[model samples]
Target chain A: MVSQLTRNERQLALVILSALALCGLAMAAIGRDDLIGGHGAFILLASLGMGFVVTSGYYHAEPSDERLAHYYDDPSKVGIVLAMIWVVFGLFIGDWVAWLLVYPEMTFDGGWASFGRLRPIHTTAVIFGFGGNALIATSFHVLQRTSRARLPDQLSPWFVLLGYNLFCLLAVTGYSMGLTQSKEYAEPEWYADIWLVIVWVTYFVLYLRTLARRKEPHIYVANWYYMAFILVVAVLHIVNNLAVPVSIAHAKSYSLFSGVQDAMTQWWYGHNAVAFFLTAGFLGMMYYYLPKKAGRPIFSYRMSIISFWGITFMYMWAGSHHLHYTALPQWVQTLGVTFSVMLLVPSWASAGNALLTLNGAWHKVRDDATLRFMMVAAIFYGLSTFEGSFMAIRPVNALSHYTDWTVGHVHAGALGWVALITFGSFYSVVPWLWKRERMYSAKLVELHFWLALAGTIIYVFAMWNSGIIQGLMWRTYNDSGTLAYSFVDSLIAMRPYYIARAIGGLLFLIGAAVGFYNIWMTARGALEESPTNADRPAAVPVAARTIEAGE
Target chain B: MDIDHNIAVVVAKSFGLFYLIALSIGVLVYVYWPSNGKRFDDAAKNVIHDEDAPWH
Candidate 1:
């Protein structure tokens, strides 16, 4: 079977096997005395055992040369699978965390299952593991298609995908083992951070090299957004994670900044993580997938260019908004709030552009569940950005800060915008990748859409009600000028909302499960292929449609 | 020390405010420049143009 693999697949298999062997050796060197080390060794051994099984399975399969010829690289396929696994793992853990909020006693032994430990695991898994892989996979697909160029090299893309997953593995496992620098989203210690930087730099170089060799005369707007995401995220990660390790052998480090500076630095990194990681990268996904699904050109090419610059320039300043009412300088906070408000212009422009791009394609959107996901994602993008700007205002921040309202706002963007757009793109891309004419179940896509939409609505509203009530309760004064509600009272008030939130999460998780099943069935050739629509041209010329119609 | 701190604040504020304004305007100008209109349009259509390419 191994001998039957194409040259590329054989080389890839060799690389995977060698990497596993090296990891096994490293684990043996670490010695299985410590719990973390023991678990690490066990996982590596299991993976090594499974590696052969997967390699053989893949080698024995015979894909058509036509299908193989279409997608020049298979790393995107690998990325999609990894992304789906993380989606289930991350969302399940997130639901578990939500349940823990309602039933604190559920942390029976208070070890790995403790809410504190698992919360970071959930965040890292979803953000870095799920969202990151989706971005990497889609960006590679978009870049190659738009440029009409193959990736500069096959090995670098694989290095990036596997290396990134390895970093995520170390980060998640380290968190469970009670090792961290306690920097919110930047919690992974020095070693994991360094590994990520190496992988990220390679990714940047790979993107640049691919773009340089493009057959097209002009670079697409989607590539610009993706490039900005990669470049800015690299800067943010490096600067925010500057730390001194006590020793090279252990997973511990001290941040370079202290006190007010540290607080400012952390929020700067945190907010930009949302901006670049969540917003910009997914915006790239939106730019490509929305237009592709709609079968139309973007509404305003100029608007995309303007918004791209506006967002990149304004977002860096807006990070200070996260540091409001803190020891950070008053002037800095004011600057933060000001820029955050200004940020609304560009955010709305992009959202409007996407919606308007559906001018002639409204019928398609109505008929297509995938297009509906993209449409709803655009609406939520506008809604969340508006909510974000509102929350950044000082008076509004006073009410919303330290409340579940912030959590609600984040979910509005994350689950509503990021995850929905990702699902839309995945649905569109998977059929083409797997040589299927269509998904196994369009009906399942529709079901998943409703489940996701209902879940988001429930989750957002529950947090809003709980947050506002908690905020109002904490601020209310009694007749004797005493606090009206104790902290526990507020916690008690949030109990129902927590349960609602968990139910919402469970619905989303179930929807994802159905989506995966549909895609898997489609890949296995169990689904009926759609009849080709000969009426529609494979590539529609942009000049054929008047831009005035979009306006 | 006080003077140095004051200078730093002034520079930071001025650079953040003015530089960002200039940059935004520069981007707007570049995007709307008539000569570049064709280029931008080509890019907007790039993805669809390559639909028949080997990799869809």
Candidate 2:
């Protein structure tokens, strides 16, 4: 079925389907003695599901002559194509690292490698590679549409893509070789960090040039958010990653700060990296696609600006919140806590604006999986922000800190907020890019949504409970004030939550696989396949109508 | 002790002065309204009128 599709689309489908098949076979072969292997299988299947959804969306429709004409003149496609390649390659590297971690015995060396190496590899691939590609691709497309201007110096966009992937490669290779500064977020060696800095500066320049040449009168709110993300993230990355390389040959570096100061600085980078890269960037996506998908103006432009500034100023201060009860100065902790509390207002402002933007289109939330994903993501963003601010309070941190609760909070934002929005943007754009009328099956999309949602809920709630319980138990004092529970006892108690969390991951992965299948069949099915060597065009019925509407 | 105390006092005063100046600038910018409703309208009109203007 996948063979009938285009090269990129076909390979993507094959990877996913093969992954799913591997999981199924593994499950049958290894009947549950060790669930670890089974869990790995589930992850592969889910990865495939993601690929399927993306490819199917890409191949659903044919580009019209006008759309093709625009492509003929521009180099943005070169960047886009490169971006796609980097994401695929990144996925493979991430998988290799993760696979090695999951089955350490399978390796030649029975060495126990920490998740520290694999975690960054997997995260950077999915977040920076996949999510970053989606952002750049969609931003290029949307900027063109809103500006009524062709992308500037198409070669530059390609440079951005190539340079970015090169940086990813450098980072991953360096990480595997054990060249790191040991920062949770800024783990990349100095050389890789330098590479990223160069690539990012180019991206910023390209974006600004394009904006300058826009034919539109007012810059869209999306541009504001995107630009802010770019600017603020650049500052954060530079400030936090100030380190000197040990030597050119080895991927070793030392941070400027030491001990607690380093931890504080790292979290400062870490949290704001979340704020700007994940939250701000996705908000930019939401601002554009939500309105475009709903076919309505944003609820209030004023609200957007207010939220934008509020988030920009407020989120920076909230980073210290991660240090809650740490020895990072009481005054600093108070600053973090206070700013975190203040962040809720801006967060809710964005969420409310997005929700209210769908004032009359609420019904579509039932029918349109894309809109539904965005809506749910918005809701989760609010929930995560509230939970984060609350956790920042020293009192609450006393119960939630260093527990699975923190993990739950992170996933609520990462899986629910970031992933959902990314998926929605893909759903909303791939059809336009592919020139398809609509997705092959809305039902599959809906299934994917529910499966992931259920998975997220179970996963988050289980962890939250487990974490708080553990925190409480650890702090609980007997009348004699002996340690309330041994560390081993806490570990035993956490087993149930881990099992539940894994199960949640399984369901989510299964949902993703279903989505993948739907997308694959959509691209490879009879309607998509060309009978003759006609060099068939992409099928975009709705965009055609929109063109007609313009006429 | 006397030298250290003097240095600390000098540093504090300098920091205080810098912050005050920065705050005033922020306040001034907040109050300033360079573009009114009419000016914004005129700018939009100008862009619309120049239909053949090159973009990019």
DockQ of each: 0.48, 0.14
Top candidate, metric DockQ: 1
All predictions: root-mean-square deviation over Cα? 7.8, 12.1
Highest TM-score, which number?
Answer: 1
Number of clashes in every candidate structure?
Answer: 0, 12
lDDT (tens digit, per residue) of candidate 2 on A399-436: 88888799899889977897788667766765555556
Q: In model 1, what is chain B's TM-score?
A: 0.67
Question: lDDT of each model, Cα atoms only?
Answer: 0.85, 0.68
**All candidates: TM-score:** 0.89, 0.74
Root mean square deviation (Cα) for candidate 1 = 7.8
Stretches > 4 Å off in candidate 1: A1-70, A528-551, B1-5, B50-56
